[model samples]
Target: MVPLLVPLLLAATPPAPATPAPPRLDDAVPDTFSGVERVVAVGDVHGDVDALKEVLRLAGLLDDKGHWSGGKAHLVQTGDIPDRGEKTREAFELLMRLEGEAQAAGGRVHALLGNHEVMNMLGDLRYVSPGELASFADQATGPETSGSPRGFDGHRAAYGPTGRYGQWLRRHPAVVRIDDTLFVHGGVSPEVPAKTLAELNRWVRQDLFPGNPPGGAANPQGPLWFRGYALGEEQGAGLALDEVLKRFGAKRMVMGHTTDRDGKVRTRFGGKAVFIDTGLSTGYGRHLAALELRGGKVTALYREGRVELVTPVPPPLPIAPKQTVPRGQVSP
Candidate 1:
């Protein structure tokens, strides 16, 4: 019996090493291009699908069934398509679907990343609605030890490196140049002016991925958060705004982080900077509007089919300091 005994330990096998995940795709495409005749830019959707659809319809970008109908025109949504509403998934899915449909139709859909998009990707779900969480439940899965499926976690995963939407979002540029105009979710700051559009987008991609400190893309003053051009003090801010425009070589910068009090897209810095947030989300009362650029002209398009020309005002200059004199002494 002892001679016939076998060593059970010898039959054991070591587990196979895991295959490493594939490298993140460089989805960031060219940030600058030309030859697009018409560009329709919308702002800060914030999960209000109805408002988004209405504005797109007014801009002639969407059909009644929520399909792309813009022909060869380009549609750019300047970020913030999540948070503050329950229909976040609906809005995201529509944009995701439109990207392909528009491209097939010889048009393009640019869904730039907003601050909220960055926040959700990085696990900040403070403003995420419960309904939004429930919407993604079927697609969410977690460890058996973890009780219910995490909806926000699922939503986050859907935009993660392996997620479909995440990959699509990654492929987009934070700053897109259509003809002579620059469209971004927020204003570009002075720090990164020297960077080419490609370089800026690369920095953003790195910031968005894990293991790097989020900078140019997610910082408070980065392209996704800067408000100086929209809400800065009138004097020096205008000069800064001009410098930003000069750096990008753009005739004007169109952005959507700061909503105007009247919920109307407004121009500042002598029309060099246009703020178009216009509270398009139900959280902001659904101010449906879009900025249309065509034939070297810019017009504000509202849901009611009214259009207003956007005229740039003169950029403000620094106030010259008055010559001072010693007390009781007059200047020569």
Candidate 2:
């Protein structure tokens, strides 16, 4: 995979200005990002542009005009851009647009890869952005002799190879690190070290993210897709501490993926990882939520929604069974 970082572009604000296309509690609009604040890290935004907007607004990232409200701080987006939520394409666009504006503002937008990006990267096609499904269907039908956007066979060849939409998604980053906290759409893979942010990134690249095989075995899954716990049988605290020991460095892991109710990342991993998923879409109708991290403290950032915790989950998932390292075999 290409290791190119974002271009140096955050010198000035993106004066191009985006006029929001009417709010519909549905899809995302260009101007929905208006007036953002300094540094804000969002959870799995599974295509809830409305919820995302609300959180951004609450975080003081958007202005009344609905532009990039974040002043000098950056925006952290944990992945899972496609699947489940309806407006995933818009969600991806939102990330890209935010990154672009961050560039112009001398600020940065950090987007970490979730399993969705990986699914999209390999052209799995099982999960797709609802917005572009029709377009993808059209591509799969081979060529249309009549309204070929360009012309006949020549026009078909002109269209970008490997399907434009899926092709576009491959450009996203698989992981992002903030201070000691490793930001991933999924949880940490057991095979990968949670010691340092750099070590984690290298593990993703070598064992999990791209390259496919770590010394010939299948690539490990990214954090978000890792639905189960990574440590032993203890409940929340055990997982938390394990995550802290592995990921949060000396601090705690502030992440989104597992369902969090009060915007608190609860775990049995020894206070190592704190989940922030907050089930933003909620599927039922309760609203979404986000966690605000600044200065060395943290707080809940919500879009004015409340979570009615009917029942707290008993025990978290069990720690993954140890994979036997084959004798005479080396991992990448």
Candidate 3:
């Protein structure tokens, strides 16, 4: 019986896998950039993927197959990708794909946060079209009527804080500086409390997420809604615009949100600001347009042709009076 006794064997438990570190917030929402030689600024897709494609192709950014063809050219989309049209999902998906492709090709794609985007995130669906909602009908988890597509719930979920599209939108900055120009969905307003570009960017990004009590970006004069540069007179808003430019060290600002009456890209404040929103979406007459900046020259790209914008030479900065040292006195 003693010889039959055997020692018990035990198995060792494996260690748990380590949890991955969370991504840095700043890395996702950068405020400034430089040394970009070529840039294409397009405004307000508004769920019109076809019009967006045409503008991108005209800008030499998209190939015939709708893929990113710009080797090193940066593309700045001034938001409003959702609402007002049927193909909102399609438009957002295209931009999302192009963003990665452009980056891999040594270029960049910037999709700024517009008032509409913030509105959707905050449950404001006034401008959201029924067709746009139907695009997400298949993902709806709520009850569906006999003849109606149950997309309201799905759309809300998609734009929720933890949703994929919501996460992507949250990563974008409200304003970004590339080279000497600033690109924003809405023009910068001097009324905002934030002074520097960095502070403004932070302010908007903070107001975009859940449980933030949303301000600034949603304010009438905030970066996402301000029309001072686009609508205010040069005498009143021009001086404020200059101060904003000086504070940010940017020579000019490019923006969307206020569509041009003639559906053309127009510059304001003596070429200190460019408005690129030409109502490219179907709901706005499907105008195809984009702004091209290359080699320090601004060109407007249209479905018909291109036009160069001549900017005036900026006045020199004021120099302080020379401090002279007294005779026989040493200057420190």
Best by the lDDT measure: 3
Rank list by lDDT: 3, 1, 2
Assess candidate 1 and give its lDDT: 0.81
Give the per-residue lDDT of model 3 (tens digit) for 1-332.
Answer: 55444332223445679854432335446778889989999999888889999889888999998899999999999889988888888888999999999999999999999999999888898988777887776655566656754587778778876666777887788899999999999888877777777678777877665465556767877888988888887798899989889888898999999998688999887788999999998778888889988887898988789888854458999998889999999988
Per-candidate local distance difference test: 0.81, 0.52, 0.84
Give the top-scoring candidate (TM-score): 3
How well does each candidate superpose onto the true structure, as a TM-score?
A: 0.82, 0.61, 0.84
> Candidate 1: TM-score?
0.82
Error of 3 at 76 (Å): 0.3
Between candidates 1 and 3, name the one with more favorable lDDT.
Answer: 3
lDDT of 1 by residue, 228-304 (tens): 88888987888887777787788889999888758888988767888889999878988888898887778998856
The sequence of per-residue lDDT tens digits that candidate 2 reaches over residues 112-152 is 66665555444444554444343333344355556533222
Worst 10 residues of 1 by lDDT: 140-149
Candidate 2 TM-score, true structure as reference: 0.61
Ten contiguous residues with the weakest lDDT in model 2: 23-32
After superposing candidate 3 on the true structure, give the runs of residues whose Cα lies further than 4 Å from its correct spot: 1-28, 141-149, 311-332
